[model samples]
Structures are given as C-alpha cells and as structure tokens.
Target: RTLLSARAPVTLISTSGDPPLHIAAERPSAAATLATLIDAGAPLAMRDGRRQTALHIAARAGNSVAVATLLGARCDPELRDRWHRTALHWAVVNGQLGAATLLVAAGATVNGVPMPIKKHLKKTSLPLEAPLHSAARLNPASGAQMIELLLRAKADPNLRDQFGQTAMQVAQGAGWSPAQLSLAWEQQYVHGLDYLRAGSNHSR
Candidate 1:
C-alpha cells in the first residue's frame, strides 16, 4: 500500500517475470491488494511469463475472493493462456468449484472453442476440450460436484473434443462407466436442468 501510495509501478516485473498484480493474485487474502494495484492503474490484461493474467493465476489457486476481485474489475474471463485454457478451465481442472461458478456466472463459454495445438512445442498441450472434459478426467466420485456445476452452467455433455470424444467418453476412458457416472448424478441432473431453465427464463 505504501509503495503504491508513493506511486511504485504496479506493473513492475519480478525476477521470474510476474507483474505485481500477478504476484499479489497468488495470495488468497490479497484481494484488497489486488484492488489497490488495479486502482493504481495496473494493467488488468497483463500477462506473466506463463502468458496468464492475474485472473488465471487466482482461479488456478482456488482463490474465490481474488477471482471475484478480478471479475469485478471486468477482466476478460475468456482470455486464454498459452495452452488456450481460460480461467474457467483452470478452475474446473483444479477442482475449484467456487471459482468455476463465478467464472460461469460472469459468462465464460461452457462449450469448447477450437484452439490450435502445437504438439511439437509442448507435451502438455491439451486436446481441444471444454472445461467439462477436464472435470470428466477427475475421479467421478470426487468430480461429480464439478460436473453438476458445469451442467448448471449449461455445459453440453455431448460436446465432442478434438479426439471426437464427449466428456462422458472421456470419463469412461478414465474408468468411470456411463451407467456408474449417470447413477451418481441422476437425481441432481433434473435439478441442474431446472436451474438452468430458470436462469434462461430470467434472462429472457
């Protein structure tokens, strides 16, 4: 705060190439600091060495407060990192339910958008899959809640990835058979559709 008050550059890069806002975002309790940096004119869209904005870092860390702070500041929720993953993707993959919910509410796309993959450059390059695909890869018993949340956000279960596999197929490949996964979520599925319908009606 003192440095900021004295006009310390909020955009200063660390040795590892993270800006001050990006660094502050990694701290769960640093929402206030993040606001201060934003007020001090930190670039909301600035990317670090990882080519991620502060929003991506916060969502990956499961920092709901930080996610809210950035979202409130109108950060582009759909901004993609080097891997073409949005903050919503990070939240789902990391099992950060709260952050994922917030991102969804803020209008991140629930469907998979085509993202070019450079297979030769990065071994971790993900298939062109939506956040639900990441959720499907998680342990079904543990990941049911995430799938529910995504469903509430109207994520299409039948949406296919670059490999022509739907999220259900991905989950099945991960050892969660359709019957097993469906049984786990059967009761909640209707409720999710009801909620989604309510939201759509309200929006209309």
Candidate 2:
C-alpha cells in the first residue's frame, strides 16, 4: 500500500520473473490484493521470467477466484507464456478444471497451439503443443474431463501437436485404452461418432 500510494512502478519484474501482480495472484486470498493492485494501476499483462502473466500464475496455482478476478479485469486469456502455452494449457496441465473452465468462458482458444521456442532457448528443437496434448500427456487421470470441457467449447478433437499425434493418440500411447477414450467421448458429446469420425479422418 505504501509503495502503491507513493506511485512506485508496479510493473517492476522480480528476480524470479514475476511481477507483484503475478505473485499476489498465486494465493487463494488474492481477490482483494489483486483488485487493489489493479485499481492502483498495475499492469495486468506483465509477464514473469517464464513469460507467464498473472492469469497464468493464478491458473497454475488452481486459484479460480483469482483467475476470475483477473478475467473480470479484462486480462487476455489468450496470452502465451515462454513455452507458448496459454493459461488454458497451464490450467489443464495442472488439472485445474475450474480455472480451465473460466479461461474457456473468457474466450481462450481451446485448440490454440503453443509457439515453438527459439533455438537459443533450447539445446534441441522443441515442437509446438496444444492444450489437449498437455491434458493427455500430463494429466491423464482427469484428462478426460479436461478434454470434455475443451470439446464442449468446440476444441478440435483432431488437432495434432508437433509430434504429429492427436490427443487421443497421445492418450492411447500413454496407456489409455480405446474403451476409456470412447467412454470419455460419450460422456461429453452425445453424438460421439461425429468427433470420432473427425479424428479418424484427420489422421489419414
């Protein structure tokens, strides 16, 4: 409050690459603190060391209230982090379905692909990835729910990652049986065959 009253630059980056807003957004009691910062003219779009915005931090922390506050503040849900992953990707990867849902409702692209990192940022080339790929590869236990949410939001079931594999293929390679995928699909979309047919056609 003192610094803010004194007009201290709220956008100053910390050594960890987070701004004050990003740090505050990580806590469950973040709503008041975030609102204060935003009201004090804090820039909501500033990125941390990893290029993650306040919304990304809130999503990764599973802080749905904070995510909602940020969204209400008109933060860009589509902003990408250093890994080219949006808040939706982080939310799905962390199994924060609430946060993912909020992001999806805020117009985050369900099938948006991560941008490839520059060569200097990696020892070897890395491929772009989609939110579904993260859910399938990193959060398979609840990935079906995440997939359902994305699918309901009109995510492309057949969207492939840099590895040239769809989310279902990734799930299958990760030991999710065809039965599991089928059941998950049925649970979300009543006309499951449409999505299945789309996936099959895209693979060809």
Candidate 3:
C-alpha cells in the first residue's frame, strides 16, 4: 500500500528474474497480496526476464487461489513463456492438480502445443510436446489423474509431439511399466466409454 502510494514501479524485475507480482504469486497467501497488487494497478500481464507472467509463477507454485485471482483479472492463461509453455503446462508439469483444474475450467487449451527450445547446440532440435506429455513425463505420481482431467477436457490423447510420440508413448518411455500404462489407459478408456453410454442413454 505504501509502495503504491509512493508510485513505486510494480513491474520492476529482480535479479532472480521475478517481478513483485510474480513473487507475490509464489507464496501460499498469494490471493490477498495478488488482489492488493491488482487493485493498485499492477500490470497483470507483465512478463519477467524469463517471459513468465505472475500467472505462470502462481500455477507453477500450485497456488490455485492466486491462479484464479489472476484469471479473474483477465490474465491470458494461454500466454507462453520463453519455453512456449503456458500456465496450464506449468501446472500440470508441477502436479498442481487444483491449478490445472482451474485453468481447464477457465478454457485454457488442454492440448496447447509447446514450441521447441534449443538445448546444447543450436543445430540440435528438441522435440516439443503438449501439457499432457509434460504431466506424463514429469509428474508420474499424478500423471494418471492429470491425463484423465485433460482427456475429459477434450484433449486429443493421440496427438503426437514433435518427436512423433504421443503422451502415452512418452509415459512408456519415461519408465512407466507396461502394467502401469495399461491400467491407466484402461481406466481412462472405461470412464470415457461410460460417459458416452450415459450420454447416449440420455438422448434416447
């Protein structure tokens, strides 16, 4: 409040590449602070040096309230950072199920394609994947539930990444045993089938 009264720049980036809004969004008590910033005319869409908005930081930290607050402030949920990963992508990658749910409900793209980022060599091309792929490869413990949520959002399970691998295939190669993969797939398939059957019966 005092800073805002003093006309302090709220969008200034820190040495760690975070702005005040981004830092505020990372804390557990983010919602109130975020609201204050928003009320004080903080730029909700300002990107840090890493091109990550406060929404991105909030999603990555699994702060659903902050994510919701940012969304309500009209932050672009689809805005991608330097890695071309959106807030939804960060949420799923970090196993932030509540944040993911909020993002999905807000109409964030369930299967937003990631732009490839170059690694060691400029000549070496990296493969870009979707949010589900990141969830599968990076958040194994919650991967099944994450995938199910995405699938229910109409995400294309069979969509291939730049490496020509689907999320399931990536999961398999990421050391998910055959049994685990089969169980996850069967669960999702059965749930989807049941939903379809229910819809069909309702139409009758």
* Cα lDDT, all candidates: 0.80, 0.80, 0.79
Write the residue-wise lDDT of candidate 2 on 152-188 in tens digits.
8887766777667777777777877667778666655
Whole-model lDDT, candidate 1?
0.80
The weakest ten consecutive residues by lDDT in model 1 span 191-200
How much does candidate 3 score in TM-score?
Answer: 0.82
What total of clashing residue pairs does each candidate reach?
A: 0, 2, 0
Q: Which segments of model 1 are wrong by more than 4 Å?
A: 116-124, 177-179, 184-204
Give me the displacement of residue 167 in model 2, in angstroms: 0.7
Ranking by TM-score: 1, 2, 3
Tell me the deviation in Å of residue 99 in model 3: 0.8
Candidate 3 regions exceeding 4 Å error are 114-126, 187-204
Tens-digit lDDT track of model 3 for 1-204: 777779888776679878889999999776677788888888888998778899999999998889989999999998887777789999988899999999999999988854434541243333477887887786456887888788888887666677666777778778887566665566556553344345446546
Q: Please identify model 2 stretches exceeding 4 Å from their true place.
A: 114-126, 138-140, 187-204
Candidate 1, residue 185: Cα displacement in angstroms equals 5.0
TM-score of predicted model 1?
A: 0.84
- Residue-pair clashes, model 3: 0
Best by lDDT: 1
For candidate 3, give the lDDT of residue 164. 65
Candidate 1 residue-wise lDDT, 1-204, digit = tens: 998778778888889888999888889777788888988889999998778999999999989999999999899998888777889999999988899999999998877566454552364555778888899888876577888888877888766677766666677678886566775456645443344345446546
Q: Quantify how close model 3 is to the true structure by its C-alpha RMSD in Å.
A: 7.5
